[model samples]
Each structure stands twice: as C-alpha cells, then as structure tokens.
Target: MSPSLTCTSLSFAWPDGTAVFDGLDAAFGPGRTGLVGVNGSGKSTLLKLIAGELAPADGAVRVAGEIGYLPQNVTLDTALRVDEALGVAARRAALHAIEAGNAAEEHFETLGDDWDVEERALAALGELGLGHLGLDRSVGEVSGGESVLLRLAALLLVRPDVLLLDEPTNNLDLYARRRLYSAVAAWPGVLVVVSHDRELLDLVDQIADLRAGEITWYGGNYSAYEEAVAVEQEAAGRMVRVAEADFRKQKRELADAQVKLARRKRYGQKMWDSKREPKIVMGARKRAAQESAGKHRIMHEEKLAEARERLDEAVEAVRDDDEIRVDLPYTAVPPGRGVLTLRDLELAYGARVQGTLELHGPERVALVGRNGAGKSTLLRTIAGELTPVAGEAAAHVPLRFLPQRLDVLDGELTVAENVARFAPGAANNRIRARLARFLFRGARADQRAATLSGGERFRAALAALMLAEPAPQLLLLDEPTNNLDMASVRQLTTALESYEGALVVAGHDLPFLSSLGITRWLLMEGRELRETTPEALGKPV
Candidate 1:
C-alpha cells in the first residue's frame, strides 16, 4: 500500500501565547508535496508537528509507515565518523568479525542476514555526491554544503516510507542542490518538503500553500500554483469592481429617495399650514406620508448594507501581498561613470583574483562559484570591509554591502530609526515616507527590527542600505536570497528593479540572478575570476 500522512484538528501555540495554527486539517498520500507560505506563516512549525519533533496542542498526526525528517539547520558532531553518522559502524564491524573466522555468537547475531550493509551505505553516500567521503572520515572534514548532503545521505540509508525535509537546499551549492533535486525526484514514498528554492519546488507533484493557518492545495508544480493564483486574483479583482459599482448605485438611490422624501414633507407641511382640507382628514394624510417616508428610508438602508457586505466579501478574496515601491534617483549613475575597480586583487584568505575589473554606470554583475570560491570575499573587499592582501579593490562611488547575515540593521531600533541612522542628514518625516514605499507604512515603520520576520527584516535592511546618505551609487549583495521565501525573493527583485545603481551580487540562485538583468557574469574558481555566461555555468564544471 502507498504511504500516507494525515493530520486532524491540529492546533498549536507558542510558549509566548502566539497561535500559529488552529483546527487545521490536512492530508497527503503517495506523492511529493511542496509546503509553501510567507515568512511567518508557520511552514516550519507544521513540518515539525508532522515529524513528531513538537507535539500539537490538540488533535493528532497519523503516518502509515516510518518517517525521516531533515530540518533547516542540521547539526552533526564533528568527531563522528561517516559510518557512525550513517548508523552502520557496529553492524559493519560485526560482519567483518564474522568474515574473519571469529564467528562469535554475538557477532553473528549482530550481522544477521544484512552482511551487505556497508555496501548499501556507500551507495547512499555516492548517490548524494559524497562518494569521496570515506566511512572513517570525520564530519569536520566536510564543508557546510557537504555536511547537509551527508545528513540527507544518512536519512536515505534508513529507507523510510515518508520523508520530510525543511529548507534542505538553504546552504547547498548548485551542484549539491542538483544532487538533492535528483534524490527528491526519485523518492518512491510520501515526501513533503518546505523550501524556497524554485527548482526544488518545480519538482513537486503538488503544492500545499499554508496561509492564515489554513492549507490550500493546488494541483501540479510551483508554476501551476502561480498560474492558478494569478487567475484567482484576476477573478477577485473583477468581483471587486462589480461590487463597487453596485455599492455606488445603492448609495445614489438612497440619496435620491431621501431627497424625494424631504420634498414631500415640505409639500405636506405647506398644505397643512394653508388649511387646504378638514382637520381630521389632513391629520390622517400627514400620518400616512410620514409612515411611507420611514419605510422608504429603512428599505434603502437595508440595500446599502447588503451592498457593503458584498463589497467586503469581494475584497477579502483579493490577496494583499505588498510590493516594495521606491524611487531612487539619487542612486542613479551617469553613463560612463566608474563605480568600482579591482586590479589583480588577492583576498586575505589566499584567493587570487587575476587581472583588472571595472564596473561603470548602472551595470549589474552576477558572481557565481562554488561555496568556498571567494565570491563573498571579493564582494567584501570591493565594499572596503576587507583590504585585499595584494592588489587594490576600490569603489569610486558610495557603496553599501548587505552581507548574508543581514546584520546591517540595529535590532533594538525601529525600522524607521534604522533608516534614520543610515540617512543621518535626512529629516525624520522624509525617512518615514521613504520607508512606506518599502511597505512599512506609518505604524509598521515603527516596529522594532528584532520583532520583524525574515522577510520584514530583509526589507528593513534593504531600505536602510538603499536610503543611506550619499545615495550609494554602488550596491554589493552577498547571497541576498539565502533563507528568504519565494515571495520575499520576488520582493527583493522588485526593490532592485527600482535601483538605478551599479550592483554586484553573489548568489547561487540562477533564476533570481537572471531576473536582475545581469549585464556581466563572472565565475570565481582556482582563486581567479573568469568571465562566463549563464549557459556556460550550467554545464559541467
């Protein structure tokens, strides 16, 4: 039978009493599912609940078979050997002992019928592109990306019927990510992954969008999900327009009815004052007119209320994902103006960047390389945060560097305050106004940076850097899309679209880099910088 996972009446709240999910029910069966949501929509929390890492406040999770889970941040003991991490050292030892003619009863018992356990373990590691890592090698010998792959390799060796992975490609390089993608595509059981990686999401059989503590299932892959959402939004917009028209018509009719009633009252009073009829007959007529006016007013009021309710329902159907809108004329550079120059730069870490490089005007550059190929180091050197060990790295114009950690913003300060610190000479009101364009309007601008979600923090940091004094004609971003949701990644792209400055961004996300209209592509390898195209980089290294 195919594996299955089900959750019923699931509810959870954080220790601080912030409710994330309430009475949420979802089910998955025999397919690869991609769980997606905004930054603080509790994607990770839901995965944890399914994996039994955290108990739900109410309801239960049911699984048809064994499960394996890989979290966003994986920690492995540095001293652990590869075989030990894969949970096969003891079994392998027992098999070896039995083969060596020391057939102790305990050794035979341990070996059981699985004498090929070592081979299976090796095969799992090889599938994950870690074949070179021997069974005896320590975890410390591997890089961060390799470590993540190693953990995944361990999970694969278990051969569970259900697999759960959370942001599995966050630290993986392009090659490593491709390996993970292959594994995900070949899985034969129920698999659910929560990730912002577009390529990874494209491999899913379906999308489970978690928004407002509810799951909305979309058939097919990420592209299909996007298309479906766009169509829904279009329909919703049409409904809103129709509702608005109806509301206006109702208001107009109500106003006209009131005016008519007022005119009738005036006419009746004039007749009564003139004594045009008998006293009793005039009194009866006046009472009838007053009752009719009251009824007309009540009917119009009811119609208006119904129109408003329809308008509210239509508006609710529309999504409210805000985009960053800003005019950065000060950041604009004139044609042929030099922004940065690097001449045979050598980083402090012994990485050599050969030859001279120059960026002029509003050129956009994409820096691509393996994990330790000095892309971040080169960006830091250009930003003047690090001095090159040999040749010179200089920026002719004002530049700002946004590191992967996003440590540019002060945690204790409000978003507006952080912007103010960077643009010291700008007036407070002006700073707040600029922040509103970045989607932090009024009260939102006053939110402390420490309390912001991943996406919000990124926006705040970008605002601070772009709105800084002297207007940063050159911008340097290191792995800017790392740890960001797809929505946040799109937001970053929108913000960059408004920036008229020279940009150098180091990232492994090819799609995002392509969206930025990168004018130049530089590959960092062998401690040297070589110009390459996106197509060339996609080929075997």
Candidate 2:
C-alpha cells in the first residue's frame, strides 16, 4: 500500500514545556492502523498532529489527499439539525429547489454532478446505526453515543482519502461499537485510529505502539501485537538474567583484584621497613608493583562499569507490569448477608425494577444496557445518591459509587489528599503506602488531580473509592472502564480482584465485566431489569 499520510521529524510540547513527542516519524497507508499506548504515551497528540488540529513545534505533516478527523470528545451543537450536522443541508436544499422547478444556475452548481446526496447521507447514517435519527431531528434528542455515531456518519459522508480517529469508541455501546468496527474494517482509504478498544483494534490491519516518543509497528492486530510483545518480553527477561550474572561476576573480579593489590602494597611496605634488599632495588620493585596494580584495578573497574551499563539497559527493556496488591478484609461480605435490595424500584427516567431483587454476599453483578437505558440512574439510586421516584432501593452494607464522569475526585486536591479525604483520620503515611499499590508512588501521589491524564484520573478515583473509610462492602461502578487505556483497565481488574465485596458495575464492556467474575448478569431494557446469561452477550465467556 502507498502512503496517504505521513509525519516527518514531528515534535510537540505543552506550554508548560512538558514534551510529548520529539523528532517522531510515522506513516499510514491505505489500510486501517490502530495506534495504541499507555495513558500518557501521546497517542492522541500524534493523531491531532496528523489531523492538523494541533500545530507541531517542528517538522511537517504530509497528506496525499483530503483528511477527516474525529476527536476523542465529540461535541456537536445541540440545536443543529442532523442534516446540518452532516454537512449536507445546503446540498439537499439545492436539490430540493431544483426538484420544485426552480432551475437557478446556483442551485445547479450547488447540486453538482452527483445528485444522490440525501440518499448517500442517509445510507451513511444507517451504516453507523443512526438511521433512526432522521435528518430533521435535533442533535440534543440523541444520546452521547448516538452523537458520536452521528459525527462519524458526517465524516463518512465527506469520503476523505485519509481519516484520523482519536478514541472513537470512548462512549459507544456494544452494538454501536460493532457498527463502528465494521465501518473501520471496510474503510478503503487510509485510516489511523488511536483507541483502547480491543475489538476495534483487532479490526485493523496493523498496530502502532507509541512508547517514549517513538512508534513501533507490528504486523497484525492487537492480539498479534500482544503475542509479539510477550515473546519480546521473554527474550528481554533472559537478557536481564544474563546481564545480572555478568554484573555480579565483574563485581567479584574487581573485589579480588582490590584485595590482591592491597596485600601486595602491605608486603612491600613490610619488606622496605625490614630492609630485606637494597633501597634502590626495593624502590624499583615498588614502582613496578604499583604500575601493575594500577593497570589491573583500572581493567577490572572498566569491566565492572560495562557490566553495570549492560544490566541497566537490560532492565529497561522489560515492561513494567506491576499489579496492585491490597488486602480488603474489612470489605468482605459473608454469605447470606444482604448487600442491597430493590423492590418495585422506579428510577427518575421511568425505568423500573420488576419484582424484588436482592443481592447477597460478595456477588458480582454485570449491569449491561444500551445508552439512555438508565443504568446510571439505577446505580445512583442504589448508592442513595439519587432517590427513587417510587418504591424502595436500599443498601444494607456500606457502599461507594464510581460514576462514569469520575467526578468523585476533587480536582483541587493532590492524589494523596483525595485518598486522605476518603479515609478520614487515617495516617498520611498509611494512605501513601496504599496509594503506591495503585501506581501512585512518592511524588506522584502529590500530583494535583486536575493535572492527571484520563487514565490517571480514573485510577485515582478508583483508589479513593476502594480505599474509603468504613470499608464499602458493596461497590457500584457506572462504566468504570470508560476512557481507560488497556494497562489501566488491567490495573483496575487487579485492584478489584482483591476486594471482598459485592460489585454491581454498569458498563457495555463485556470483556471487562467477564474478567470481574460476574456471578449474575442483568440486562436493563424496556424500562425493566431482567436476568440474562453470559452466553447471551454474544461473546465467548
């Protein structure tokens, strides 16, 4: 495939002088490319540079054809009509005017040679699962996920030769994500997407991993990338072991040389004091001994230095996969202990729970639903953050709620201070000791919450909720994995694995929910909650 988009010697930095990319070079051809990396690896920044949304501090971006870009956050004008948002309002109007017997030259010019604008636009919308949203409908009438699809549909209608999407699946439901995945898989033009969606990435032709301001290309999709990385890590581990052995051997040799040199110096001094030989002869012997000892020491020292350098390099080659380890014995709920109960619960949006629903012990529940299905409302009601319109929703055990927006954290406070607020009266040292397990170490815990990246913010919020005082025995999370990169999601899974509590997580991510060991699956549909099975999720359990 020939290249359609390319960045040469690209460099960018925030106004605070924090460098994101320095002298980076990348290219994308007429095939889907998944750009992936950790939270702060500058994946989105690179996309913005390619899309011309951000000006690079140096170098240039070259594109062979027109480019379309979808940003991480899609915010359309709520008052705009769907047709206007799709960039076809004027063309459609011209076609309508021509149909109404107004043969104005301007209308003809606007209509152009391709006259199937409306049909094509509708088709694009339908392909993205937004067909129900008619051209006249206001943007505000749709949900967040619908808005995302709508924007994507607009981009598709433009038919740009190159497309740049930044975390395009951030708020999409499973069905919507599938639609997007299909569109990406079918894209014939150059496509470069920065995302954490595994399924979406798996649809791509290749994976571009951004790390430390550089991009490493992999031959296939995310699964292939993982397998390749695993092999590389294993080899790197062996190199580390070899380097360590070499370092230790060099240290031993240096120690032995130092010992011999010291003994020879002592013997020479004693011989000189005893005057065993002539003074001139003793002096020459001492000089020669000193030169030989110096050379030997230098050689051993140089070898030790080289060995240490090799060890350091080997260690750096291995990936850091440290998992959070914490004991939450206080959060345990014994069997038969009621955690929560809902009786004829009616949420604010008219969504209701049918019959009596009871949660006991440390049961893990997966709350799966489409966008605008009132999942968040139900969770809020259960957490007592929102009162039900009618009927009862009660929690017998202490509970904490982690909303999708992650507003639980105080942006003005440092990460440590936020945890301290949650665990009131707890010692700062103890709070920091626990925060370290969450990957916030030393000065990192002192970083203001406002300065954290999307992934970092989620981790801090999760840490606060899990480490809160009174030890919540029931945790209600609303879309807990939203905006989290794969690594952060793994860390969350590790952290939750240690929690001995009841969990009700409302999310569309089936893989994440499955990883949590969900014992029960609840589907929220038609204004009611119904029991479902893992097999019904359409993915292998």
How high is the lDDT of residue 455 in model 1?
Answer: 86
Root-mean-square deviation (CA) per prediction: 1.7, 1.7
List, residue by residue over 1-541, the lDDT tens digit for candidate 1: 6789999999999999999999999999998999999899999999999999999999999999999999989899999999988988889999888888997899988878888998999999999889999898999898888888988998898889999999998878777887899999999999999988888999999999999999999999999999999999999999999999999999999999999999999999999999989999999999999999999999999999999999999999898787888999999999799888889888978787778888899999999887787888888888878888899998999999999899998999999999999989999999988899999999999999999998899989999999999899999999888778888998899999999999999988888899999999999888788899999877643
Compose the digit string of candidate 2's lDDT tens values, residues 298-397: 9999999999999999999998866788888899999899989999889998899978999999999999878878888999888888889999998999
Q: Residue 404 CA error for candidate 2 (Å)?
A: 1.1
lDDT of each: 0.92, 0.90
Q: So what's the TM-score on candidate 1? A: 0.96
Q: What is the TM-score of each candidate against the true structure?
A: 0.96, 0.97
Per TM-score, the best of the predicted structures is 2
Model 2: per-residue Cα lDDT at residue 303: 100
Evaluate model 1: give its lDDT: 0.92
Query: Which portions of model 2 show Cα errors greater than 4 Å?
Result: 1-3, 539-541
Clashes of 2: 0
